[model samples]
Target chain A: MSCLETIQSYSLRSIGIGERLLPRSDFTLCEQVVLIGSGMIWNVYFGLMALTTGFFLATAIALGKGSANPWLRKPAEWFIFLFRGSPLFIQFFFAYFLFLNLKGAYPFFDPFTAAWLGALIVLFLNTGAYSAQIFYGALQSIPKGEVEAADAYGLSGWSRFRRIVWPTMLRLAWPAYTNEAIFLFHATTLVYFSGFPAWQQRGDALYYASYFADKTFNPFVPYPILAGYFILLTLVIIGLFGLVNRRLNRHLPANARSKMKLRLNLIR
Target chain B: MFSYCSDPDTLERLWWLSCYLTTGVHFSFYLSFLKVIGILAVTAPVALAFGFAGAMSARSQILPVSWLGKAYIAIVRGVPDIAFFLFFVIALDQGFEWLRHQALCPDWTDPIRQGNDFLVCPQAKLPLGTAPQAVHQAYAFALAVMTFALVFGAFVANVIFGAMRAVPKAQLETAEAYGMSPRQTFWRILVPQMWVYALPGLSNLWQVLIKATPLLFLLGIEDVVYWARELGGTKTARFTAYPHGDWRMWYFLALLVFYLFMTWGSEKVLSRIMARLTRGQATTGGEAQRKGAPA
Candidate 1:
């Protein structure tokens, strides 16, 4: 089939549309590209929703970890440690079983077994924990003078944080936050592998790529195609984060603001 | 297991669990914790060598050699590492087999790539397809170790490369003024100082390496996650001596605590090492140490 015909047939294939069965024999480059590209839709969905939702929770948890009260501080500290310390692969497995038991106990939790909601929750918590640590570090490093100035001007708790602290902390945290977003997006590839069945072969890019590899016994084509898609996605993330970074740091004297570059070191 | 544990179905809760925990597979499950530690112990030094080579080459005066080093650092790190793990295990296995195919089957004219089958002479099969179980496990493990090393070495190279640059340019210049060769300067001046700068990144990388050990399950090693699933799944009475309901949550919880203890202990040990390394250096930690030296 022509590339256009193939796209039409498999554009929504990851979500289980337009085709019931995947290509089984005589695999084409076009088919691999289309199906894998189609699977990227799920990656985008998981990353986007989890990142957006996780952002607020991350901020709250960061604040909690920084708080003076041990009641607030200890739980937040443990939450971050529990998620950050363990492998996210095991987190998915652990969460699946927990949800399965919960579903058995309550009929309302039946939807929790499906990958879409259940897996999204895991990614959300995982990213939230990681980003929280970055934010906590950033928050701690906020200059003493800034908070002192706000306090001297009589800016109290919430407003002091809102006005004097939050923006600066974000500015400091932006580079690492950008790294976290890129990692989280890349991490979406793991959900399918982590006990969360794709349900009718509806999986992310690596899933489809591996499917083709299993069928054709040729690792060369499909995996590289998947990597190409990821490279594009990674670039898009960097570009978007870079743009926001520039805008956020625009007011800082050029030398004072940190420049965001793509750094893949030590994502956990 | 006590005498009362002989009939587990008839036994009460405490006795039933005591007997169940002593099963033969549970012993294997406990040993797998050491396997995770084994990977960390072996991979750290091997990956360090790979990183040192990568960083050294990237710093080389020769352009192509430098580019090779830079590309190695970039490509493995640019993508999610798990993808590399998935790709290389199959690719490396196939590559070894293909080489053996060429070497062992010179008179054979049949194509190795026949449709979907990677057909090769029987001798070309890795582990000879007739090797014992231990050899098969060892081969799979060797593949896992290589994949872990290659992926992590790139990250380490990035850290080392930055650390090398962070060394004062004046220090290298002094060595040059003293008529030291570039190689001598690197060995004496740059190599000694890079660790002080590299420690923070390496410590962080070490934590990441710890968390990443569970991905061994993905590489097809029957690591902790595999054992958890296998042992925690519901067991019918007919299947074995002990039958139980699904218990994966508890198994994974134990795994979670094990990792947390590891990371917590790692933090303590790394901090002590950092303090020792920071002595008489130029970084903040060293500055503080020098200032507080009277104690």
Candidate 2:
């Protein structure tokens, strides 16, 4: 089949939409690229949803941890510790099993058996814990003078936080937070490989790539396509985050604005 | 393991659980934790060695050699390491067998790639096919260790290279002015001071290494994750003694706790080490240590 025809057949193969069966034999370059590209849809889905939701949760966690009330601070501290200390791979497994057990009691949790809900939830919390730590560190690093200035102007509590503290925390934290976002996407590759089954071969990019590798018994072709897709995705993440980084630093002089470089902070 | 455990059906709930936890498979399940630890112990030093060499190469004056070292560091950071974990094992295995094919089975003429199949002569198979199960397991584990080392080594190289640059230029120049050779200055001034800078990144990489260990299951090794899934699956009464319902959640919870403890313990130890290393140095940690020390 032609490249366009191959794209048509395998474009949504990951979600079990278009193709009934994957190519059995006679593997072609087009088939590998198209199927893996289809799998990128899941990666983007997981990464985008997890990062977006985790952003709010992470902010809450950072604030909660910094609060003087032990009720809020203790749980926030433990949540950050538990998630950050454990491996994301183990978190995925633990989450899958937890969700599966919960499914019996809560019928609403039936989708947890699928990769979409279960693994996404794990990634959500894992990234939340990571970024919470980053934001908390940034929160501590905020200049004392800024908070003092806000207090002098009679801005206290929520008003001061919303106006002064929050923006500065984000400005200082954006560089590290950008790294966290990039790694979150990279970690999405582990979802299909984790305990959560792909549910009808509808796995992530790594899933489809490994599938073709298994079929062809040649690791050369499929993996590079997956890597190339990921690199492209990483570049796009950098671009989008760079734009936000710019807006965050819009108030500052050009020399004072922190440049957004992709620093690969090691791991969770 | 109790003497009263001849018949599982007759045993009470607590006894049955005790016996179940001592089964041979359960023993292997417990051993897999050691395997995870073993992977960490073996891979860390090996990776550091690779990192040291990589950093040295990156600093080399030769053009092509430096390019290769730089590329190694860059490419590893750019891609998701899971891809390398999945890719390198098969690639290395095929590479080894192909090398053996060319060496020992010279008379054979079959193409290694026959359509969709990777066909090699019997003599070229890793572990020789007639070897014991232990040999196969060892070979697989060795492949995993190598893959881990290669990947983490790149990260370490980045840290070490930056650390080397972070050392004071004045210190090195003073050593040179004192009639020390370039090599002597590097060994005395650069290497000694670089550790303080490298420690933080290395600690971060250590945690990342711990987190990445579960991917061994994807590499087809029966690591802790594989055993957790296998042993925690629902077992019927007919299947074996002490059958239980789906208890995977509990198993994974234990795994989670195990990792949390590991990381917490490591952080404590690493901080202590950093304290000792930073003592009497010029940085903030060192200054604090100097102040905190009684005269």
Candidate 3:
């Protein structure tokens, strides 16, 4: 097949759009690229869904962790510890089996056995725990002067948090959180490889890449393509987070403003 | 195994449980945990050495060497490390075999890349085609360790590079003033002081390294995850002792608790080490110590 024809056929192959059968032999460069690029749709979906939903839970968790009441604090602390302390690979396995058991009991959980929902849930909780810790540190280090200044303006409770505490926490946490976001996206590649089976070969980018590698007995080509796709994805994440970082730090002087630096804050 | 374990069907309930847990496969499962620890023990220092060399090269005055180091660090940061793990094991195996083929069969002219095959000479095969199972396992384990070292080394390099920069410039200048050569300043002054700055990142990397141990299964090693799935799968009465239905979840739960304790214990130990390292340093940790503030 021509390169264009190959693209048309396998472009959405990951989501079961065009192709039913994968290429068996004589794997062309174009076919490998198209199929692997097609699989990126799942990666994007997992990362976007988990990161968006995880953001809200992370905020709650951060606040809960900082709350003075033990009723609130203890559970939040343990939640972070449970998710953060264990390897995410094991979490995927455990969660899959848990969901499978739940499916046995309730018909409503039937869909959770598939990679889409089950793996997404694991990613969501994992990122939530990690980012919550980052946010908690930011919340703690929120300059006391900012809270005092807000108190002077009669800002109290929710408004006080909305006005003074939240923005500063985000501002302080944005850099580390960006790192978390990138890693979460990276972590999404683990979904298909984990316990949750990818229904009908509709797996993620790494999945397709590995498929090509296995078929051709060549690692150099397909793995690099996968890496190239991820590097692009990482850049996109940095660009998006950089925009938010700017908005959060907009009021500060140009020189005094915190710049987003992409560093490895190595959490699994 | 207990003497009563001979006939599992005739055993009491508690005895059945005890015998079940003590099966030979279970012992292998237990040994897999040690295998993980062994990998960590071996990989840590080797990766640190790789990282130190990488950091030094990145900070080198020579342009090409610095770029090479920077590229190594940057690539790992962007790519999912599982990709590297998957890629390197196969790639390295083929790479070694290819080199061996080239040396051992110089007169051979057929292309190695023939459609779906990597046709290296038989003599050049990793562990050789005739090698024993033990040799093959050891070869695979060595490759896994090398892959882990290469990937984690880049991460450590990034940490060490930043830590080197974070060490106060004035201290280096003072070393220079004391008639110390540039190499002396780097070895005697910079390397010694950089550890305190590097400690936080290194500790974080250690936790990451721990979490990453499960990926050893992906490398085809019969690690804990492998044994868990094997032992926990459904077994009918036709099979040997234990007849259980899908106990994989519990096995994974046990593994999860194992990792949780491992990481938590590491946290406690790392914090103590951090305290010891920061005792008299000039950083905020040291300042807090001077003020008798609790960490």
lDDT of 1 at A101: 89
Task: Tell me the deviation in Å of residue A143 in model 2.
Answer: 0.4
**Per-residue error at B56 for model 1, in Å?**
0.9
Question: What CA RMSD would candidate 2 show?
Answer: 1.3
Model 2 C-alpha lDDT per residue in residues B46-66, reported as the tens digit of each score: 999999999988988899999
TM-score of each: 0.97, 0.98, 0.98
Q: Give the winner by DockQ: 1 or 3.
A: 3
Residue-pair clash count for candidate 3: 0
- In order, candidate lDDTs are 0.90, 0.91, 0.93
Residue A264 displacement (Å), model 2: 1.6
Order the candidates by lDDT, highest first.
3, 2, 1
True contacts kept of each: 0.61, 0.77, 0.76
> What is residue B50's positional error in candidate 3, in angstroms?
0.3
Model 3 quality (TM-score):
0.98
Error of 2 at B286 (Å): 0.5
Clashing pairs in 3: none
At residue B118, candidate 3 shows an lDDT of 89
lDDT of 2 by residue, A1-268 (tens): 9999999888998888887888889988999999999999999999999999999999999999998999999999999999999999889888988999999889998998788888988999999999999999999999999999998999998999999999999999999999999899988998887778987788889988889888888999999999999899999999999898999999999899998866675444
The fnat score for candidate 2 comes to 0.77
DockQ, cand. 2: 0.77
